[model samples]
Each structure stands twice: as structure tokens, then as C-alpha cells.
Target: MGEMRAAVLFLWIQCTSGWMHPKCQIYDSGEDLGHFLKWTCNYLPRHAEHYTAACEDVTAIEEDLLGLPPNINTFCISMANGQNRSMSLGFFSQFQDLEYLYIDGCFTQILPTGNIHLPNLQHMYLIVKWGMGSGCCNCHIGPHTFRNLVNLCDLTIQGYRLTAMAPDVFHGMTQLQRFIISEPCVEDLSEILCRIMNIKSLIELKIKAPEIQTLNQSNCSILNTKESMKPVFNNLASADFSFGEIPHIEEGALAWLQNLTGLSGAFSQEVLLRLPLSGIQQIQYFSCSGSNEIDIERICNVVFLLSIKKIHLANANMRSLSMSSVELCTGLEYMYLGGLGSIHPSPHLKWNFITSLKNLNRLNIDFLRDKNPEICSFQKQPITWLTKLTLLINIQILFAKQFSCLVTLQYLDLTQNLISNIEDFAFMGLTNLESLDITQNKITQINANTFFGLHSLTWLDLRNNPLIHNIEAMSFTHLTSLKQVFLGQVNNPLTEPVIKLNLTLIFGGILSQLTHLYISSAMRPKGYMGQRVQAG
Candidate 1:
């Protein structure tokens, strides 16, 4: 009993000593300290030696931030109601151990003074929300304001109404690797891009200045120019620019980056029309999004360096794909094309490009309306390599032998296709298919042979249909590996009010592997609206 009392006394002494520091005070009672500024500081979890501080709703900026922990490593300040104070200062140097800093609020100026410096800081985020305090500009950051941050590696500055920024604002950041900027009012982006030319250690760079109307050779010439004895950027691997519908991009403007591999952004037709002739190469993954109708035949005449492995086009109208368009990119493994408003139909080409690819694994084409009858036969060639496929076209019928060539397919989705009938042997050769989704269609019945050859199917979804009013016996006997099924009805006022299917008859087959079943909008004789069953 004496030893236990001694141990308890020792722990109490340690706790008291730790909290006795001037910076580690506790203020959980919300008592006013008689000061206009309100802030708090505490030790971070698992980092008993470090502290984080935050101040919110600040209305003023003084020369020094007093009454807070002086050695904090992380600091965040939000001045949503700032009074647009401008004073030349070096106030942030007090946090000698500061590593991360975040500043957010609406103001006319942020860090406009050049005296601020934090040599130990590695990351900084500055967000200036849209405001009309001055009604002239949201925020105006000065040049060379952060030249003293020698150890800064990652920096992000996002403001839509930034009007003034010096060309040499990013001068002393030698170790900078990732830089992101989303200033839309800066029309002359070349000035900013020129400042980062000397950052040889940069790996990822992204800019979204939509107001820049043109991207020409002169705007990007400094990137290829030599500073000391060699090119400025030697380690840049990824660069994406979203310069909102620029009408022109001079050839060779972006071809200088020899080590770049991944590129993504939105470009105009004038740029994509000249991409093949732009001389840019070495890109392996490319993703583009736009609303313009792009002539894909011209861009796919010759493979871009023949090193492309994935091409994702989101909302870009890529019209009429031919075998030669995709066959040239021999290393492609995944292709995703989707657009909701694209109306140009592809001339139903025999999708030989799919079977010709030995490395292709996934293909998704969504919302590209094709009213052609031949578009239903996706696998005209013998396709035994693709593992996943998705088609959301307006196909009305699943004819016999339609998917017979997809013997190795594992996952298939044909949702919202208006399919009304599935002939016998429609899925005969899909022996390895594991998951199937046919939701939001017009399928009215489930024949015995509708899923005859999907012996390995595990999950089936048939929700939001007109109504499954008929079911031939043994409709699910062939799905030996089935585990989950979704059967939901989409109410139609024109259809007669009646309970179409009996649950016992649908589950009469040998469904020993079934574990979960979902049924919605089901009008049962017992008045149960929806039912969900879980089995062993």
C-alpha cells in the first residue's frame, strides 16, 4: 500500500509540471481573457512535444501575434471579417519550430510585405475567398514575399480575383516540389511560369488560370532556355494546365519536358487538332475533359510516343473510333470514354481494336447515345482477354450470341439501356462472369435460358424495371455461384395494380449459395411493400 501511494504521487507531479508551462494553458470553461483576439493551443495526439494553434474570425492584424504558444509547429488563422490591414512586418518568425501554416479569409491583401520569413517551414496554404470588401480585387499578394522560406517544399495559393503578383515571387524556394495555383484573373501566366523555371527539383505542377486566352511558343520559350549550363527543370514529371478554351497553342510549346509522364486538363479544339504535330512525346497517361466535339480520327493518326497506357476522355466528344485510331497505341491497357451531351453516333465498326489489344483489361463507354442497330454486337471479334466491360447505350434487345465471344468477362454493366427482351443463349459464352447489372430497363420477364451460361455469376441486379410479371421455372438454377440479387419495381401508373411474382417460386431452384436478397416496390398479398431476406 505504501508503494502504490508513492507511484500515484509521482504521476501527479509529472502532470502538473507539464501543464505549468506558459504556452500550455487550458481554457475549456470559455472564460473571457479581456482580449479582443480569441485563440487556443494544445499538444497534438501522439506528439507530446509538439503543439498546434488556431485562431478564427479575426478582425485585425497586428505586428505580432501575442498570448499564444511561441514554439508551435503548426498554425492556422481564419480572418473572415478582416479589416484589410496593411503593415510591413516580420511577425511570423516567432514560431521558430513552425513546419506547416494555413491562412484563410477574405481580404484585399495577404502577405504583401516582404519582411516575413520562416526558414523551417515546409508547407504553406493560403486561400483568399471571394469578397467585395474593396470591390476592386479579392486579394493581391506581393512579389518576393516568401523568398526567405528556403526549406519550403509544397505551396498552394488559390484565389480567383488575384490581380497583381510580381514575376520573381517564387525566387528562393529551391526545394519546392509540388506547386498549385488557381488564380483566374492573371491573364499573363507566362510571368509566373517563368519564375518557377529555376526550380529544378519540381515534380508536379498544376495551374488553372482560365482567363489566359492564348498559349503560344513565346509564353513557354523560357522553359526550354538554359539558365546556367543546362535546362532549368530536369525533374518535372507531371504538368497540367487548364487554360479555358484557348484558341491556339503553338507547336512545341510543351514538348520540351523530356521526363513528363502524366498529363491532364481541358483544352480547346485548336490545341487538340495540332496535338499530333505538336512534337510532345513521352506521356504515358493522358486525361482530358471538355465540351467540344473533337475529331478523334485526326488526333489518333499516329500514337503519341507509342507509350500511352491509359486514355480517359471525360465529357469530350470523341466521335467515330476506328481500329486504326486505337491500334496505333499498342500499349493501352484501359480506355474510358464518357459524355452526356454528345449526339454524334459512331459508325458501328466491328470492335476489333478490343480483341487486338493483348494488354487491355477494362473498357467503359457511357452516355454516348448510339441509335444504330449494329451497336448491340460489341464483341463481333473473339474477345477472351477483357475482364470488365460497361455499355450504357440505347440497346433495346440482347440478341442470341451477342456476348458469346466474351468467355473471360468478369464484370458487366448494361444499365438504363431500354432493353426489353433477352433471347435464348443471350449470355451463353459468359461462363466466367461474376457480376451483372441490368437496372432501369424494360425487362418484363426472366426466362429459364436468359442467364443459361452464367454458371459462375455471383451478384445480379434487376432493379427499376417496368415489372417482372412473369418468371419461367428454374430461372436461377444455372446461377450456381449466385449470392446476392436485387429486384426492385419502378411503379408505372399505366400498368395494372397486381402482385406479379411469388417469392417462393423465384427461390424454388437450388440456390444453396444465396445469402442476401433485396426486393422493393413489391405489392404482396399480405400488404408488405418492400422485403429483404438474409439467408445462411
Candidate 2:
């Protein structure tokens, strides 16, 4: 009895003496504290050493964060109303072994200012939500604020109201590798680049500023000329400049970035022409989006000069694309062209360019109008050019007579179109086709010979179509290799209940090799036995 009393007394002393009793170690102060504790005790008892505190109507932070566990490595503090709260200096003095700190939706006006030191800290994320309130002050990164975080490697600051960052804000962070600023609060791009040039080890940098317009010599001159005659970002391999309305890229501006391999942005034809041709030729991947009419001549010139393997163009007018122009980039393997508007290429123009791409393997083109019967007149001419093509997406109608040339095609997507019927032998020559998606269309019924020739087809999707209640059983009988079928949510008027389907009769013996089937409840009638079909 005496020993039991002594043990109990010892535990009580530890709890009050800042030794952190195992049960009372992790402290959570929030509106859902009771529920959080119950869940932690039941499922995550091993992680009870972590501490999280919710800030509410608090003017000071030192009093609430004092006397924490000495071994605490991760600390999370979130403000219920970030606009009303702020952080002060020396607030993290107790957590000496802290490595990761996350401050979400907090800190307004300014961060802590002092000889703040976090010896072991490696990753920090500060998200300030100052834009939610009206007439609120912007957050500022004061000088010497992050001076003592010598070991910090990754830092992310995301806030709409961040207005200014001192030139030397990241001065002492020599070990920083990845820095991301979403809609940065800074006003000048030059200021950001000047500071980023100091970090030599950074490999990936992303700046998403929608308000900025034009990246010219003023902001990008640092990359053109280096102080020590060395590359500014010696290791920068990938850079994204998603600024709005970037009209100009001065010549020799990006020359110093010798190791850059991938660049993505919406650039104008004039800006593209002015780019350092030699430097850009070294890039292996390029993605460009713009509203200006695509200059086929200049684009072809770039393709001929560069050894790029993949090219993606969005919102560019391809009305002027010609066979001769496309034939210049024979080295390209993957091409994705989208948002082409209502322009439809003639049958000869489409066939000529596609057949000319001898090295092309995957092609994706969207937003083109329906394939007119006039375009199918080229069926008389044999198209033995697409022998190497494997995948085609968002192209015109897939009439078997017109597409029989692509004997090696494996995957085809004909979704989001005005396709109402799949005429007999629509995919007759595609013996190697593996997957086909005809979803989100106006298809009403599947006739017996609708899919007569897809011998190697393994997966078929007919979801979100207005399929008739009664389907011909032999419609899919030819697909002996079929493995999965999706027939969920047949399009029906809101006022009417979904029409049920008889699975055993519709699928017949086609389910012999089927492994997976998806159908909605609306497609099943009352008193239906799903297990009986599997048993048979």
C-alpha cells in the first residue's frame, strides 16, 4: 500500500514539474478538443507527444506556449481569426529540438523581429489569410526576421496580402533548396529575382503572379549578366513564369541560365521570335499558351532549330497549320494541341500532316468541330502514314472507313462530341485497339453490329449516355477479350425514374471473361439479385 502511494505521488510531481506525463504530454486547445483527444487515444496513442494549440481572441502568445515538452519536434499553431492575431519574437524559445513548424491563417502586419534562432529547424510554412477582411493591413517580412534559421531548407509563404519582402529577407538561408511564393506580396519581379540569385543551390522555382505584365530587360537583366561571370542559378533545371500578358523577352535575357531544360508560359509570337534561339534549342520540353494567332512559320522555325521531344500548345489558333510546316518537326514524339476554337481542318490537310509525323507516337487535339462527310472523301486515298501512331484523342469522328488506316492504334478517346450512333464496322480496322471511351455523348442505343470488329478491346466506357432501356445482346458479343464495362447513370429527365436493365439478358455470354462491371442503382429494377448473375 505504501509503494502504491509513492508511485502515485511521483506521477503527480512529474505532471506539475514540467516532466510531461505520457498521458498529459500532448495538449490540444480548440473547439473540438474533446473529440480530438478521444480519437487520438483510440487510434493514434503513439503520436500523443505532438502538440497543437488553437489561438482565439488572444493578444499575446508567450504565456500560452510556455513550458512545452523539451523533445517536441513538430509544433502547429492555427488562429481561428487570423486577422486579429499576430506572432511575436522569442515565441518559440522553449522548443529547442523543433524541426517542423506550420503556422496557418495567422500573423498580420509583421512577423517576429529579433535575434531569433532555430538551430534544428528544417521546414517552415506560413500561410496568412489577411485578404478575408476588409481594409486590413498587409503582412510584411521584416529585416533580420529569418536571419538565424541557418539550417532551414524549404520555406513557403502563401498570402494575397503579403506586400513587401526585404531584399535580404532570405540572406542567411544558404541551405534553402525549394522556395515557393504564390501570388507573392512583392511589387517588383526584379526584387524577387535579385534575392533568388543569391541562393545557388535552388533547383525548382515557381512564381504564380497573375497581375504582372511583361518580363523584359529590367526585371530579367540579372540573368543576362552575372557579377562573378558565373551562372546565376547554376542548377536551375525547371522554371515556370505564369505571369499574365508576358509580351516581351529581351534577347540574351535568359542566356546565363545555361542548365535550364524546361520552360512553360504563354508567350507571344513576337516574343518567341526574339528569344535566344541557341539557348532555347537546348530545352527538351516546352509548353506555350497564348491568345495571339499562331505564326506557323515562326513556330516551324523553332521546331526545326530545337531538339524538343514534347510540345504542348493551348488557346493558340491552328487554322493556318499546313503539312509542310508540321513536317519540319519530325523529331517530336508527343504533341498536345487544345482550345483551337471552331476551326476544322480539311480532310487532306489533316491526313497530310498526321501521316507526315513519322516519329510521332501520341497525339491529342481538342475543340475541333464535328468531322463533316466532306472530310471523309479522302477515304479513296490510302493513309499508310499513321503506322507508328498508337494513341489518338479528341480527333474527328471515328468512322471505320476513315480511320481504318491506323492499324497500329491502341487507345482512342472520342468523348465530348455530337456522336449519336456507332454505325456498323465503326472500328473495323482497329484490331489492336485496347481501350475506347464513348462517354458523355448522345448515343441512344447499341445495335448488334455496333462493335463488330474491336477484337482486342479490353475496356469499354458508355457512361453518362442516354442509352435505350433495351440493348441488343450481341452488341458486345464480339468483344471476347472485354474485361470491364461502365454503364452507370443513363441520362434521364429529372422528373422520371431511371429505367432498370436486365444484366443477364443484355450481357448474355459476354460476361464469361468479364472481371468488373459498374452500373448505377437506377439501372437496376426492384427485387433484382446482383449475386445471381455472378453465380451463373
Compared with the true structure, what per-residue lDDT tens digits does model 2 show for residues 166-206? Answer: 55556656778877766664444664576567676777777
The prediction achieving the highest lDDT against the true structure is 1
Cα-lDDT of candidate 1: 0.62
For each candidate, the alpha-carbon lDDT, in order, equals 0.62, 0.59
Q: Please, what's the RMSD in Å of model 1?
A: 9.5
Candidate 1: tens digits of C-alpha lDDT, residues 465-504: 8666677777887688899998775332234454445544
Alpha carbon deviation, residue 342, candidate 1 (Å): 5.6
TM-score of each: 0.69, 0.72
